[model samples]
Target chain A: MARITREEVERIADLARLTLSAEEAQALTHDLDTMLEYVQALDGLDTQNVEPTAHPLPVATALRPDRARPSLAPEEAVGNAPEREGSAFTVPKVIEGVES
Target chain B: MAQRLGTLSELRAALDDGRTSASDVVAQALGRARELAPAFAATRGLRADRAAEEALQADQRRTARALRSVLDGIPLLLKDNLNHRGEPTTCASRILDGYVSPYDATAVERVKAAGGVVIGRTNMDEFAMGSSTENACDQPTRNPWDPTRVPGGSSGGSAAAVAAGIVPVALGSDTGGSVRQPASFCGVVGIKPTYGRVSRYGLVAFASSLDQVGVFSRTAADAAALLQVISGHDPLDSTSLDEPVPDYAAALDGDVAGLTIGLPREYFVEQGVDPDVLERVRDAVKELERAGAKTCEVSLPHTPYAVATYYLIAMAEASSNLARYDGVRYGHRATGAHDLQSMYSRTRSEGFGAEVKRRILLGTYVLSAGYYDAYYRKAQQARTLLRGDFEAAYRSCDLILTPTAPEVAFALGERSADPLQMYLSDIFTVSANLAGIPGISVPCGFARDLPVGLQLLGPALGESLLLRVADAYQRRTDWHTKTPPEAS
Candidate 1:
């Protein structure tokens, strides 16, 4: 069975918030399919009883006392923003007619 | 400087005995960065002003007999992905245009706390993707041994910088053999410590689960000197291990008596690997046996599934991690956006390189609703089995030995066209990351006049033992001391 199609690749690009050119979409369709086929080696493994491992080490939530500490100044936080007005980042209009 | 700067220890000795001043050493390192830029293209930019100021402080502290540590006054390079306060952490990608770090990465902060001088930011594969540095926005870093060949990457610049003698030590992040493969190609020592062994606060997540900051140096001891300063728990990084930091330098007793080094039967097979590279690794094992270490053959049945599993997990994590680069808060923004959604898509599409996009797309596909169970979940279960392989192997041996890469560095653009071929170059090194164990790549010998890396792996928090074995083998052989003729 075909693992993915060019249309699916374009859908994935959309899902990833990336707009791909037609050439890029076609190329990635082939590349992603090849990689998906290669990864089929895992189909032979018996992982039915095996538990999944998201992290290599056991992790516990790290909690500290609630207290305000020194943090990045507002200007510093927005210093690299493409467009900022008074320590706030300006983005494209989010709502239907409201300015953002 | 009166004496030639070779290793961190040698430079420290020179500084202690008044052979060279800290300012002069920093000047020499900065000068080398500029002189070698055209040939290697290793660093993004040199921090000449900051280095001079830090060197002066180090000298004043030395005069007061308040020398901080082994890293004090030592000039070193940081991979461009890592934040260095005021410096731009580009990750060698155009997506991060006009962005500068507001705070220091935990590793960088620790190094600065010890008075270590930051010399420059080294180039790397964009977002620590790709086995070769060719995926970067900047010119690829070439191997110092043969300028026409590639320095294996995404940490290729750090490896090349150390190999070419631009600096004694450099920092790089290893998600899937980024540091070690490049180190092997460049004939330097690269070490990826156990997961959570080093803090990842400002390292810029490539794969949050597998990413760990690593070191590249000419010798294990020099790596140890820098690793010591950078390792330890940081409250900033929740995943950072809270365990006590070991005395890495003191562990280098050059003694490997009674240590059992396991050689994975799968990795030593006749096919896939270059014959000469295998021979060098076998000879390296024999040298270790001569120095009082025992060898055994072990099986990691899940070895064949590592590459697939590694990519699945890495890409899934990368997709999520890279979603932050959508141009709203920082980094490159599209010029003309009619709406918010197009702005994000256009910014990312324009900013990311080919490889980065390919990975993001694959990652998105794997994690999508329909394919999640078949791909991502299955790969995770296989990851558990893979870790079990290491756990079982470690019961019989204290350390595992293998070739770092199947072959030496290939010519530039040789494997760039084939992503699978380039991904396979990391075959021998990625397993350690998947298992979240410590592994080191040390120069064993040469093949076709190119460096071959002999890898040594240990279980979780086994850095001390791994370093001991590597330090012992390096002591017995001159491979670690051999410098590129062009570099010398």
Candidate 2:
């Protein structure tokens, strides 16, 4: 079985920045164990020499003509914005961070 | 009024024959929508006034070229994550409450140009994450079958709308079974075309590679009617396939005789799959076999890792895609923040729900620098193994079969207590996505009154064959025609 340890759970929580309730966290531990235990089924299969296929269709360098059609007015695009400033939809600033 | 009949093709044929005007159809559809919305929670922000006005012009000489496609005069509910001009595309997330779209998605425009009346936006998961509509930060969309139970999600509203007879067809996005799972749960025909078959231009991305825009309808024929209008190349979405879209409705009755159908032995393993659901799917396969399709017991040995692989990849893409949701350009921002970092932190923290945050965290860790090779890379390799398994299975069979989900709809909060359990709901549906192929869910039967979906998964570019078999199976059974409790 692929053992999912408490440290891994804490690490996943830290990386995801989740403030889990004691109950939710404990519940997640058991569920994750179940998930990993079940997923252990993959480890039994032989994939020794299989070259990974990423893109379904082969990559092509052929390019298409760049075209610009009518654009939705700024007001229309930002109309779904829960918060806005002028033509822009305002959101929290993002940058470098080791968020939990 | 009879001109604007139940099926989309019938409605379009009526328009072609000078029976009723598009305006009349839109008005009637709007009236019905108003009548049904309260009971089913199918739509938000109905655009009857706008749809009726635009549809009136369909008869004018100006829109002649646009009305030539299969969907002329048909109206559809676009799940809210898909942006349409002048429509609120909220994705059922409180973060975008009352938001409006400045532009129409390539898919939306294609349907509209084919003379489909842009009707209204349907409710969905906050960002297309959960299986039940209960995840919507807004209101949960009720199942038409049993209002107390859920219409599967994250496209719950789209399925509910069509299931309740409010609309003949609607668009939904599938990432780990959002479209097909719900179609199965709602007992409707749901088709997730090949991953690149439709453009994702105006769709708010959930999981980039796996997110596919699909259609839901009362029957495979109706779904084909909608697909014929929506599937095409779009310069807007780089990932959209440039190939020609087949006339799905024209090709509806393609021969299924002698086609090989693979029954994946692994999919039947008890991870939580209900026995009744399994039996119904087996019964559906027997029907297909009776119709001349050969059934073979096959194995997708790596099927067990699908859920884990799907979550890691989907969450990784989600974290990256949602990075653009910072306050300045799109989405919501917190009320106050002392500095830039705090502003981003608090806004994101407050904006996303617990599940979404949990996914983002899991995603970030899997893709983290040190752990990349072990978690992310290993999963990608497993994806390769999974695809190889499918390839080997397909060599023996033309199409594969399985139950769309483990069981029918769980009560709203039944699995919400554990996110892993919630994610497990998608186990069966995620494999096709990993391989970038097409899969669809057709109503198998009801277990305790809730519908079970019989999933038909096909090789890449295998939709035409898949639909033909599904249509054939549906023709022999009345399952697809059974309306939910709300409709009755």
Which stretches in model 2 have alpha-carbon errors above 4 Å?
A1-53, A61-100, B1-5, B13-21, B59-66, B269-271
Clashes of 1: 0
TM-score of each: 0.99, 0.88
C-alpha lDDT values of all predictions: 0.92, 0.78
- Per-residue lDDT of candidate 2, residues B40-154 (tens digit): 7778768877887777766663245545556666777899899887677777775565456777888898887777777798888889988987778767888888877888888
In each prediction, how many residue pairs overlap at the backbone (N, C-alpha, C within less than 3 A)?
A: 0, 14
- The complex in candidate 1 yields a DockQ of 0.91
Cα error, residue B422 of model 2, in Å, equals: 2.0
All candidates: CA RMSD (Å): 1.3, 4.2
Q: How much DockQ does model 2 earn?
A: 0.31
